[model samples]
Target: MLVETVTLQIPEILYQRLVNTARATQRPLEEVILHALQTGSPPEWDDVPEEFQADLAALDKLDENTLWQIANSGKTSAEMERYNTLLEGNSSGTLTEAERLELMALRHEADLFMLKKTQAAVLLRWRGHRVPTP
Candidate 1:
């Protein structure tokens, strides 16, 4: 594949960390950085589980307006309160079994929400909208 080179002004600490990671993994620095850029958070759906594929397909079907709405969706006030409560409990080492389960459920919900939002953003960009960087 043809490749283009671009210079980046990364922080010294970040650059060191990337170098360390590359050395530890026995991969070239450029390869490591390119891999990270290609497969960012909420990775491509090609190897995702079947259930997630369904969700991705659903998101792909949404119109631009609907995609915009999904992209802007965020956790409700109650959800935020619960998340805060869970964080407090975790910090105090006092999470009950039920609370732990609830926290896990909330985390799963947040992941799904983020996936939908990311997909929506990609769709909007595909439709020629100037989607802002997250």
Candidate 2:
């Protein structure tokens, strides 16, 4: 693919965070930035799974306040406990077939939720919202 170089004056704090991310991930800074630019927002509906289409559509309708709420939400305590239990079972080679499937489904849901939250954060940043750092 053809690529063009462009100059950007990134804020020092954001630049530091990007640099840190690149170092932690063992990726090139340019690659990290490019990936963020490409995937930080909601993807096209056609590119998403059929099961996620409705969720994505709902995300599309979220106001800034609602988006903020979604972006800040974390897994419930019950979800965390279940995840830990599954992890323990897997590590011990004792997970039942049903438990294995449950763990996989839970992981999938967590991944989807994270994707949505990230997209919401990107939207918030685009709208000039002051999102707090972790």
Clashes found in each candidate (C-alpha, N, C closer than 3 A): 0, 0
Top candidate by TM-score: 1
> Which segments of model 2 are wrong by more than 4 Å?
1-54
lDDT of 1 by residue, 1-134 (tens): 99798988886644654564455446687875775577542224545556566686565445567778888888889889989999899889999999899888888777778878887787566444788986
Pairs of residues at least 3 apart in sequence or in different chains that clash in candidate 2: none
Residue-wise lDDT of candidate 2 within 19-80, one digit each (tens)? 65455446688886886686562333435677776675555445677888888999889889
Q: Which pairs in model 1 have colliding backbones?
A: none
* All candidates: TM-score: 0.61, 0.58
What are the lDDT scores of the predictions, listed in order?
A: 0.69, 0.72
- Which regions of candidate 1 deviate over 4 angstroms? 1-44, 47-51
Residue 99 local lDDT, model 2? 96
How many residue pairs clash in model 2? 0
